[model samples]
Target: MIRVLLFADLQEKAGIREIEISAEKLTINGIREHIMELYPQLTAIKTAMPAVNEEYAEGEQVVKAGDIVAFIPPVSGG
Candidate 1:
């Protein structure tokens, strides 16, 4: 299982900060697609950035079972 971290308003919107999913060997893009399919409310994440192991990751980066995947939405502040 891979641990997925949701940040900012996504956490509140999803009603959870994190979740575990079975996505061994799937790329970040694949995970994003899966999330969109499962949770239509989080469709905003379609344009969000993905991170793995605390580092910014590419869409094609494959995720391992023990990896932590985080969907980071664009932040705004002034």
Candidate 2:
């Protein structure tokens, strides 16, 4: 079970900040697709940077079965 932490409007839209997705079929792209499927309000998810184990990661980044995933939304505040 990979944990994904959401923020900003995403949490509200998805109704939870943290989620456990099956790592077997879980990819960064797959997560985004799931989010889109759950919340159609999110037209785009690219603005968010995916972080795994405390470092910025790519879409194709491989995640372990119990890794921690953070979906960090871009912040504009100074």
Residue-wise lDDT of candidate 2 within 1-78, one digit each (tens)? 788888786777777888887666467877777777767876546678888878998898777787888887777876
Clashes of 1: 0
Clashing residue pairs in candidate 1, if any?
none
The root-mean-square deviation over C-alpha atoms between each candidate and the true structure, in angstroms, is 1.0, 1.8
- Error of model 1, residue 41, in angstroms: 0.7
Say which candidate scores most in TM-score.
1
TM-score for all predictions? 0.91, 0.80
lDDT of 2: 0.77
> Worst lDDT window (10 residues) for model 2?
38-47
Candidate 1 Cα RMSD after full superposition onto the native fold (Å): 1.0
